[model samples]
Target chain A: MAIAEQLQEFCGERRRDLVRFANLQLRDEALAEDVVQETLLAALQGSDAFSGRASVKTWLYSILKHKIVDTLRSRRREVPLSGMSNADDEDEGFETLFDRRGFWATEHKPHRWADPEDSLEQQQFWQVFELCLDRLPARTARVFMMRELLGLETAEICQELAMAMTNCWVILHRARMGLRLCLEETWFTR
Target chain B: MMNCKEATQLMSQELDRPLTWRERLALRLHNLMCSGCHQYRQQMAFLRRALRSRSGGD
Candidate 1:
């Protein structure tokens, strides 16, 4: 098979993982789909020197990761993102996003009618969780979902997202910690 | 009343196992002292169970 054809097969096979990783990086599902499409196109064009240092999966992931960074940098966002740094602020950074001192306004207890198994036959849970997921910062939320929701191994996540294992652990730790804190502080306090 | 942090941590672990003797005792002692935390825990427990029953991950 031609290198481009082989690479196309590779990208097609791992499309789900690519989209998942891209979504984690970009936060917007639609935008992440775009990035994955762009990554595959770029990969096809550069197939001449495709090194075997990393698995094809990892190489594609690396490309997608850099693409997200490049996109963000082009937009000139001053705040550094989580996946960009192997060990920057870690999960501790998300805690600050919550308004701790302010009363958690829990007057209207909106129940999530989001049971995938219940709502749709074989429904994708992401569509449901994505509702609240949008509220979290892209990096912190992605780390949390990749670990807790998707059940991806921490080691794989560390390598894919370019996060340290400690940072990965800390990210999960803080995600659980921050979500509970924010929910209680914001929803119940009011 | 249990402080928000303690209850939140307790709830996270509770997803995997039923509260142990030590946890139950600690929680009991905590509830006697903190009404807000106690009520918070009760409500959270109900919410969690409702979610769990739907999740059926177990």
Candidate 2:
């Protein structure tokens, strides 16, 4: 097969996973599919850029990542997180667990999670984690994924989302707390 | 004395930026005395590491 034909076949096989991964980041199914389709096209057309340095999957992901960012930048104007009006309150319930002295209230202490490394290897654990992530409010989920998944810094998240630094931290803290509690209820406790 | 709230905030902050010696000392002392805060700290680290290693999850 020609290089173009081979690359097309490779990317086609991975299209579902690529689109799902994009949905995980972009959180919009339509946009995710759009980027994945664009990624396949870019990968097909930019064969010269492949350079034989990384796996085809890695190269495709890099293109998808940039495409997602570009999509985010274009969509940011409409998203308008500017007023800080949506001050996240999902954390309030968790706050009550910590007392005035900042100690855990009698029943609210975090239980020891089972061997997390073991859990990481379990496919179901990722499903639970992904669901928990989806449960987070949109802005908070975006920040948590950017920081944890994309490995973006706090500064970049603030710039991309047009959020204040302090607000970003607050959202992150709440996001973590929410995920823990969600996992406990859905997977850990069960 | 860093309360659990303050200690947890510092713990989350540590992920974003380097902590000062004083802040580090404060967190260490707090964790030494507070199992809840210690568990909270560990959970945060575990979550971050797990997500990072898994490439933000599959």
Candidate 3:
């Protein structure tokens, strides 16, 4: 196949992953959709020069991430966070994430939990997982999703968010805690 | 104060279960001395399991 044809085919297969990555970065499905479209176009246009230096997916992810960061930085312009919780965050069970109780409380174990990593392969499991994720504070939500859902490294997310190591760690912590609290209330009770 | 950020993060992992080596050590160290963190971890564990089931559930 021609290089463009081959690159086109390769990207088609991984389009969902690309779109998902962009979605997490941009947070708006429409904007993510636009980013994917632009990324695919760039990949297709540049295909003739593609020397296979890296796998197509990696290259595509690189393009998508840069495009996303550039777009976000230009558009955001330091607007203070809107404090908008998800309209669908109807699952109020995770509200404790916002509460300030015994957070440092060095007392009891609360309880012990079994592993759900085994069940994580299923789409439904991920759906609710994504739902809870959508509830996190936006920056925290973005950093956490990029690392956990999309498998970006801590350093990469830190760079993308322009956060310090400690700041990134703290965001990940809060994101995890919020998701944990949310997931426990929504998923574990059964 | 561990702050909501740190507490939330540590508590979140504990909820997810089978704590990492780092978390286990932290919990062990804190729980050994501080009764509060111990109970906190315990409650977090319970809350986590309960939430997990609900997640895979309807």
Candidate 4:
């Protein structure tokens, strides 16, 4: 099949995942749809650049990442402070995970997740992972995805989000703790 | 002694940047006696691997 036809088919298959990824980063449903649309259009126009080395999904994701970053940079000046304030501003919710003396609370203690590596091969595990990820606060999810999925550095994330380095670390720590607990509860223990 | 809270923070920070020797030493000491924290660190590492596997061709 020709590249154009292949990419059209790819668009139908991967569009939902791409939009979810963009929505996580942008936190705007409409903007996420627009970016994904633009990504597919760009891929179609530059179909010659569709090197066979990368899978179609991966290639589309790379394109989507650029589009999301561009949208973010363009909107940086006008982003309402309120939008960025709620996610990392307070530590009160996370504080309950520890006790007065800083020990893990009995109910919140981390248990051994047996054979976690095996879950990678299971489709159900990814479904649970997505659900847990969706439960995170929007800004927190964005920061975690930017760092872990997009492979951005701490300094870069801080700069992009206009957040303090310490604040960035706090958000990441919260994300990791929240995700670990969610996975343990919903997947590992079950 | 570093408590579980501090130790887990160090483990998460380790992913973003190199811990200072003092911080590393403190975490190392805490993990030795803290099974919960040790498990937490391992889970965080596992999470990272899982995410990278999904974001292939990056």
DockQ of 1: 0.09
Candidate 1 per-residue C-alpha lDDT over A1-190 given as tens digits, one digit per residue, 9 for 90 to 100: 5566657775766587577655754666898788889988888777666886655655666676667656655533545454243432544553343235321234422233223234323334334433444555556676665555344567776776666776666555555555544544444344
In angstroms, the error of model 3 at A60 is: 2.5
Per-residue lDDT tens digits for candidate 3, residues A1-190, read 5566666664676577567656755778888888888878887887766777666656666677667766766765665333334332343333443345644323212344445555455666666766776667676776665555445677776676666766666666566556665666676443
Question: Which stretches in model 4 have alpha-carbon errors above 4 Å?
Answer: A1-6, A84-87
Model 3 misplaced stretches (Cα beyond 4 Å): A1-14, A48-55, A78-115, A143-168, A188-190, B1-58
Over B1-58, each residue of candidate 4 has an lDDT whose tens digit, in order, gives 9888888889999999999999989898889898989888899999999998776554
**Every model: Cα RMSD to truth:** 10.5, 3.1, 8.2, 2.6
Candidate 2 lDDT by residue in tens digits, A13-73: 6577677777987878998898988888888889887886666656666777778878877
The best candidate in terms of lDDT: 4
iRMSD of prediction 2: 2.8
Residue pairs in steric clash, candidate 1? A104-A185, A104-A186, A104-A190, A105-A186, B1-B33, B1-B34, B1-B35, B2-B37
**Candidate closest to the true structure, highest TM-score:** 4
Q: Which DockQ values do the candidates obtain, in the order shown?
A: 0.09, 0.55, 0.15, 0.68
Residue A24 error for model 1, in Å? 3.3
lDDT of each: 0.54, 0.78, 0.58, 0.84
Model 2 residue A149 lDDT score: 68
Overlapping backbone residue pairs in candidate 4 total: 0
TM-score of each: 0.38, 0.85, 0.56, 0.86
Q: Which fraction of the native contacts appears in each prediction?
A: 0.02, 0.61, 0.18, 0.79
Q: What overall lDDT, based on C-alpha atoms, would model 3 receive against the true structure?
A: 0.58
